[model samples]
Target: MGNTPSRKGYEKQPEKTTLFKKEPTGITYRIPALLYLKDTQTYLAFAEKRSSPSDSDAKILVMRRGSLQNGSIQWSPSQEVTSAFLPEHRTMNPCPVFEKNTKTLFLFFICILSNTPEHRQIITGRNKARLCYVTSSDDGQTWSQAKDLTESVIGKNVRRWATFAVGPGHGIQLESGRLIIPAYAYYVPFKCFSFPIPFTVQPHALSIHSDDFGQTWRMGKMLQRKSCECEMAEIIDHEGRSHLYCNARNTHGHRVEALSESSGAYFDKPRLAPKLVESRHGCQGSVIGFPAPEFVPNDEADSIGGTTSPLSPDTQTWLLFSHPTNKTSRRDMGVYLNRSPLHSSGWDQPWVIHSGPSGYSDLAHSEDVEHFACLMECGKESELEQIAFVSFNLSDVMQTVDKREKKEL
Candidate 1:
């Protein structure tokens, strides 16, 4: 750990390194999703290999593995996971969730027809997306054939939607054996659908969930009003009940946050998270609920999400959110923390990672103690050049805690 000054005092910063950058080849990498497999102590970085920075040019999904050893991370060679797409379709967005009991990983994404752009979808009220996924049994070393779930999972729900997308980042599995994939759909009122609305249709964040593992998945009711490009986390509220917390991008003034009782299915109306800002034109962000370092016990279960620690302000599940810090531009990737999950005001000022030209980041809590990783889009001149993986520690983002409160046992 490296020492850096914080609001409280000197704090430790995790070693940061760049995992991948675009070579001389014109092919660019963007939209990163990260998953940390505790059992294998491996980190999987997934992204889209685009012919250019444009969204419609995505050709294939690519990934690389990073092994944690000693105090540093060793990354493997990049490899193509699959290119299963029709000649006129492109695969994009990679969201992965792991089931501890079954030891299976599910990868979710959407395929968009080449000729149909998002603008056309909203104007015509027709979505040209196919929801699909693949499963891997041995970590990410192997994967099952791609399965198109458009008819089964998104068939009727998308009929009224102008456009929809699965997470471009990681998803979460709750303590009660539920898998939730963060998603969003653009809705146009019937009047707006018939003719071009004054403005582009805003989106609402929703989830595609599975109760009996990943055997069958269902779409959750959309969260209230304009929210998009979301991520979900299982947080233990003050009442000792497990609640699903959602944080999403918004075209409105600020980021949107909401809570759900039945896992990630139904949500309360959303409100702006004042401390979290959405870069102009909106930007995709990532969120996760993690065991507070001071409260985590040595004998905790190995499952991803489960029972809460003894109910207390100090023992509650904490949240970490990542996005760009700039109010008008996508730059200076920042990670914000909220010790109190039930309230939006608990979010602290961010600890910045990339200080320039950064956007669309995903956060993953390290199974290894006191560490976390961020997979982000950044470049020397712009945010779309390449995808990079950065690592940080708890102390880095816990800057506001007083000396005594931030101290580790």
Candidate 2:
């Protein structure tokens, strides 16, 4: 698989549906996080509606509902989920995690004081950010007032962070009822080489989790240094023990991945996942795990033995990953599958989604329809101009089918 050329070999091409377009609605729209509510059987698409493409200009968080009706996604008009009209402050990073037991949704994000830009924060080593969230019982039809959680959940840790952000994508809830919001914080280092820069800084992925169904949240130990912009997945291994899998953005050529044995309270040292390389500075990617497909025999191995071989440890479940296939440009969004959750080499060659301009994406599965959906940033001219949603069946990915199925609102 390593020898497979990047962006050269792809078979399947699914239909692309535009969910949110920039302008007349908002001057600019980006950073999408898609959530599928099982109870409501609805798709919630969240994005930052900004005055411009500037990071600090997104004053409002917008959402839209898409009902799963008769095998098609029928989208509703977009509405403002939350906004901060106060000067120099804006909401960013829309990350939502559903609590199955309570049928509640928690939307987590960061409020940044624009007076201090990210570059200044990186240099000064002080984060002018607050963690906040809103809840909904009616599957995004209505939402509770936004609540600030920085003081209680992060507390003094903010003092050490230069800048921090929660998932620009979706978070996950484990089978054990542990809810986690994947996040990253930039920390300024004490040592500096006074030459090209006055100080050094690094980012690492961490988790803020809730055990009591969003009543309270707690910080988890940070993953190894230099990881950022992560997404989390709950994976049950062959041993029957549940593990938290983290796939994070990295600037060091490849994606950073780690596993947590303690339901995301802590993670082992992170390692580079070579199969999932990052584009340029890095791009946020999406990951999801589904039930493993029935095992098929390898003809070469079967010829050697008459006895049937048991499935490998990696076959306990399957993981689906989405990201840009190119190492340099955020184009050609691809979906990768891996039967082994722990081994980096197990990822199959990607099945390309958008062969043109594409950026950050979030993945969700529909149990009723037995298909997966990808909400991503894509454009005809530039990658960040519009947010689109695409759906595909598991067979399309596994078989690499070259087909497109269109469904319009």
Best by lDDT: 2
lDDT of the candidates, in the order given: 0.81, 0.81
Q: C-alpha displacement of 256 in model 2, angstroms?
A: 0.6
TM-score per candidate, chains pooled: 0.88, 0.89
Q: Which tens-of-lDDT digit does each residue in 127-188 have in candidate 2? A: 88889988888888788877888899989877778889999899888888889999999865
Error of 2 at 386 (Å): 0.8
